[model samples]
Target: MSFSSIAAAARPRYGLSCALAALCLSYSLHANANTPPKIGGAPVTSVTAAHYYSFQPWASDTDGDKLTFSVSNKPLWASFDSSTGRLSGTPIPPANVGTFTNIVISVSDGTYRASLSAFSVTVRSLVNSPPLISGTPATTAAVSQPYSFQPAATDPNGLRIVFGISNKPAWLSFDSTTGRLYGTPGATNAGAYPNILISAYDGYFKATLPSFAISVTVTQASNGT
Candidate 1:
């Protein structure tokens, strides 16, 4: 073959090979652009009540595309900052004190999206303060007479208070829910009762008041002359 004819034959094949390589590169780039972003982060297990809490999640796209972050099923006391991929807020007491599960943190690269559900957050209850018993109970009672009194108490956490009594006399009845002590003493029950104890509870903690004594006197019956 002549030199011109050989060069002409090789030119077509070289051009075809270049075209095939360009097509393959174009397809690779397109595929990478469609790849989803990978989401990654750890969950906070515990946070103090009424305190600020914050956590940042991470995401990346293989194609270097811009990513956006979001969250779902977040607690009402907290919020997710989509622009910064941060979860932050202050949690209230009691109502916010519990384990929260399956908070979905998601990331998207416009065309594709990814999610991480491994994060669970816990808002711990505030330290409980002992309930306080207020005032002293009356130390005297009359036989066959009705008596009723409620021991005053307070809880620093605003929790409901329960009342209890120890070494109670048979004539006296105690109410745990309302903290009331009430009952009628029989005529034969006239006597001195000592070391009667009263206590208060605020669900998680308790406090007791000092001991006191009660004297029940007999009622004199009227006789017609």
Candidate 2:
């Protein structure tokens, strides 16, 4: 072959080799590209002092890589679980009862990382308050009739309230969580139940309502003249 012809042939071969090399390089880069780890969850913003609190974030890596968890500006009383991404502990009064701000939680998969939005936690001291019991119970019920009474109760401190009765009747049933007293009064259950005092209790205090009575009697129609 002539010199110019040989040169032109070599030029096409070189160009083809360069194109194949570039295609291989692009495929290698795309196959090895790393997708970042993803982390997210809603963290508790407010907690009562002397009460247990916990927050756990969900984390995952699309590339199926092992993840490592990290936290920044963590509270002194709280502890972190790097493997599970759990933040938990009890805050004490007078010391940890304040706002902890700009807390960051992140997860890394060696090549890339992701993080949840920065958050803050406010710890407030526990202030106890007595629960209030309201509503009236019926004083009389007829035989073979359904009788129901539920005392409305609430706590000022937003704590849970449990109910109790000092002199509950044998024919009635009481629910502690909702303060409901209910039952059907049969003919044999017709009688006078007295001195029934309903009480509400929070974790730190208790409140009681005035004592009441329930009287079950046979209907006048049943004892027709």
Candidate 3:
């Protein structure tokens, strides 16, 4: 074979190799431009159900690509909204009192992925540690009688109080923050009350236990023949 012919044949092989190398380089560069998968998840800063809370993730691609999400380890009594980035649910209480639960949420943005978010959610039960109720005496006449009650709750989280009462009358008044109970007895409130439950809410959407009920007996005045 002539020297020139040998060189010509080698040129095609060299060019093919160069093209393959370029393709490989392009792929490597494309992959490197993208950000590495990161594990990131923020706990619901506020109440998830009553209010709206979200789970956020930080990821990026070199080409400024869009992001998608996937949850690997979802928590109980909780849900995530990827489009709106909302993670919400009604808190469920554990069997034990004042118990806390840890939620795991997995976040992925299509190309990038992360797992086992450390700070996802802290579920708490609103029971046992409810507020207290006072003012109503053990015995009171039902006829022409009015009684009032307020939320008397104590929680470690310093939760805000919301007032609610049963067997309420127009003259009855209640305060959530303060455990003040004031009300005049109506004529109908002469019977015995089995229990008066008051509910106090906490930061974790937990209701106070016992509902702060009070037993009462009514004695009517001597008007019988």
Best by TM-score: 2
Ranking by lDDT: 2, 1, 3
- TM agreement with the true structure for every prediction: 0.48, 0.64, 0.40
Regions of candidate 3 where Cα sits further than 4 Å from its true position:
1-37, 41-57, 83-90, 95-109, 112-127, 133-160, 167-225
Model 2 vs. true fold: TM: 0.64
Worst 10 residues of 1 by lDDT: 216-225
* Rank list by TM-score: 2, 1, 3
lDDT of predicted model 2:
0.89
TM-score of 1: 0.48
Q: What is the per-residue lDDT of model 1 for residues 127-176, given as tens digits with 9 covering 90 to 100? A: 87788887678888887778776778888867778898999998888999
**RMSD to truth, every model:** 11.9, 5.4, 10.1
Which candidate should be chosen as best, given lDDT against the real structure?
A: 2
Who is ahead in TM-score, 1 or 2?
2
For each candidate, the alpha-carbon lDDT, in order, equals 0.82, 0.89, 0.51
Query: What is the per-residue lDDT of model 3 for residues 103-150, given as tens digits with 9 covering 90 to 100?
Result: 444445556655544453444444334434334343343443455443
